[model samples]
Target: MGVRPPQNDDDEPDTITFGIAALDAHLERADVEFPVDAETLLTQLGDPDIPYDATGSTVALSEAMDKVHIQHFDSEQELLNTLHPVFESYRERAGNSILGQLRALLPF
Candidate 1:
């Protein structure tokens, strides 16, 4: 985890870096294998509206998941347990992204 100094009072005091290490640690604890690369998955989770331009990837959610071969989870609890940390880390940075919006709706 990393902290970014706020540029202004409105800015968040801390910024979480949702990079490979964090993802790997979470996955290791969850005991699950995600076929997608951490960076790619994080990018998608962070900004669904932004096109994944590295390899001309589209912005469509289904297309992106398909490209990464993200299939079913071992169980719903496992999925939530694995993703909750990532979501928490990204809460401030997410802004209007899908995860951010969902976070607003869900107490968890």
Candidate 2:
């Protein structure tokens, strides 16, 4: 078990704590650094960031983002299930993402 992670809870299939304090500090720093995904979508919709004009009414960009927020967690479980195999297929794809980069830089 050289370089193996210690078990934290038997209930969990895996436990890989890089350590609470270090992981928390890294997470906080990463939070501020990651870009919001929808910003690009909004920008592409229009310059001056035109609000989302639905079937009959105009909705502000903030309102659109809010609407998206509500829908996000609603599909979390379903999305997780759907994406599980995709994630499993490209285990290293995550390594190319921001979190992966941060993980690579961790001293642990």
Question: Which one wins on TM-score?
Answer: 1
Provide TM-scores for the models: 0.23, 0.22
> How much is the lDDT of residue 66 in candidate 2?
44
Weakest 10 consecutive residues, lDDT, candidate 2? 48-57
What is the TM-score (0 to 1) of candidate 2?
0.22
Any runs in candidate 1 off by more than 4 Å, and if so which? Answer: 1-72, 92-108
Q: How do the residues 32-89 of candidate 2 rate in per-residue lDDT, one tens digit apiece? A: 2323244543343331221111111123333334433332222323423433343333
Find the candidate with the highest lDDT and give its number: 1
Q: Write down the RMSD of candidate 1 (Cα, Å).
A: 13.4
Predicted structure 1: lDDT:
0.42
Cα RMSD of all models vs. native, in order, equals 13.4, 16.5
- Tens-digit per-residue lDDT, 1-108, candidate 1: 333433556755654333333443444555544455545544545533322221122233333334433355555344445544444443345545675566557532
